[model samples]
Target: MREFDYERAADAAHAVATVHADPDAVFLGAGTNLVDHLKLGITAPGRLVDVSRLPFDEVTERPDGTVRVGAAVRNADLAAHPLIRARYPMLSAALLAGASPQLRNLATTGGNLLQRTRCVYFQDPTVPCNKREPGSGCSAIGGFDREHAVLGASPECIATHPSDMAVAMAALGATVRVLGADGEREIPVVDLHRLPGTAPERDTVLHHGDLITAVDLPALGWATRSTYRKVRDRASYAFALVSVAAALDLDDGVVRDARIAFGGVAHKPWRAFAAEDALRGAAATEENFGAAADAELAAARPQRQNAFKIPLARAVLVATLRDLAGQEAR
Candidate 1:
């Protein structure tokens, strides 16, 4: 561990100002992911501003039915929240499918969203990874890439975003409230993460000192019938080889609306916009589901070791949609 200054912030304003003033300062929330990077020598901040005890820990349902989850809310608490489990079950399931119970107990909603790729190359300081050090060639490009990206991958990096919660939030169309030097603003969850373009080092659009206050999930009645399905090599504590977060709205066997997002396959959460467009107003059948999956995966550019992810993703999306549609019918 390296020597660093530490301060427990009194409030949000103080936290934001302290971090924004120092270029080498970072906000510490739960320190679940940040600490790991610190130990691995991936990041070294001169100062750590503790924001875990801030007032952003509540989970409230607004009058308009939007569920606002404070950034500091623990993943376990959010997963077990009555409102979350009853309404947005997909989000709850996604949270549960992530890290083990011990880690989830300390992981915060904002910290979970800020988690970087779990690519082996990105974690090892000795390896050449663009995400770890910009301009260094990506080792995963020609090396072990079973867990790498298949969609929206640039030559600079083929790493995938490793957050199951963000995938569910993307499908749910959640909004992230941020506080920065310029004051507060709202960013859609889908727009929060960036594709691995020329700037693979930047995982998200968040600039330095931008603090996530809360995530607002819009009231989508259809999401009540949604679910998150993750397929991994192991049964527990394993990241997804392919995952699907899907919601369906059916009326008399016809799909009225749908929302879909795929995980473990892209630089960010792969929002199935093409699939949603294909399923809208169409019959909610297995055949239609296949068509929708195909529409979205048509743009996939799988790498050598991860070509199987394309078919695996297609199967998971179709099966998840089918299950949701069936549940709605019952």
Candidate 2:
């Protein structure tokens, strides 16, 4: 690892200002991802601004029934919080499904969102990865692509975002609050992550000096009936091959509303807007659900080894919606 200077940020403003002052400075939250990158020689920032001690660690309930989760709130604490377990069961379940107990205990909300992809090529500094080194070309595109993305993937990159919490947030319609050098601003969770277009290096829309303050989850009564389903290579401590976070509101066997997001499938949490659009006002049946899932995966372009992901994603979506419908029926 490269030697670097360290600075302890007193608060969010100080963190932002400190990063703004140094072009190569990076804010350190839980240090789970940053530390790993440093050891792997993936990132060697000149200065490390520790923001874990900042005031952004509280989980508060708003007057309007919305939940405000500070960026530094630990994943385990967020999952076990009474309000989160009671109201946002999907979010809680998503958090529990990720990593292990020890890592979740140390991983913060913002840090989890900012976590990098687990692509082998990207992790190996010797290999060429567009996300790691721009214009160097993406080795995953023609290499071992079983874990790569099928949706929203450009020819330059096919890496998938690895975050269970992000999929839940995308489905729940959460908002991200950030403190930048200019001031504060809010970004929707769906818009927070960027698709791998011509510029595949940029994972998110955050500015250089932006410090995430909190995540605001709006009141969604239907989320009480939501669930998260993940399929992976292993039973535990494995990233999703294709995961679904779904919330459905049914009225007498007809869909009233729906929120769906898929993980391990795209550059970001892949929001199934087309599927949701097809599900709304449609009969809550397996056939209808299959059609909706098909509509969403219609644009999926899979590689040779990972072509099975398209069918797997479709089945997962159908099964998840069917299971939710059964729950609603009961």
| Each prediction's TM-score versus the true structure | 0.98, 0.98
Candidate lDDT (C-alpha), each? 0.94, 0.93
Indicate the residue-level lDDT of 308 in model 2. 93
Candidate 2, 27-133: lDDT as tens digits: 98899888999999999999999999988889999999899999999999999999898888889999999999999999999999988899999999999999999
Q: What is the C-alpha RMSD of each candidate to the true structure, in Å?
A: 1.6, 1.5
**Can you tell me which runs of candidate 2 are displaced by over 4 Å?**
327-330
Prediction 2 global C-alpha lDDT: 0.93
- Model 1 lDDT per residue over 151-193, tens place: 9999999999889999999999999999999999999999999
Residue 85 lDDT in candidate 2: 89
Report clash pairs, candidate 2.
none
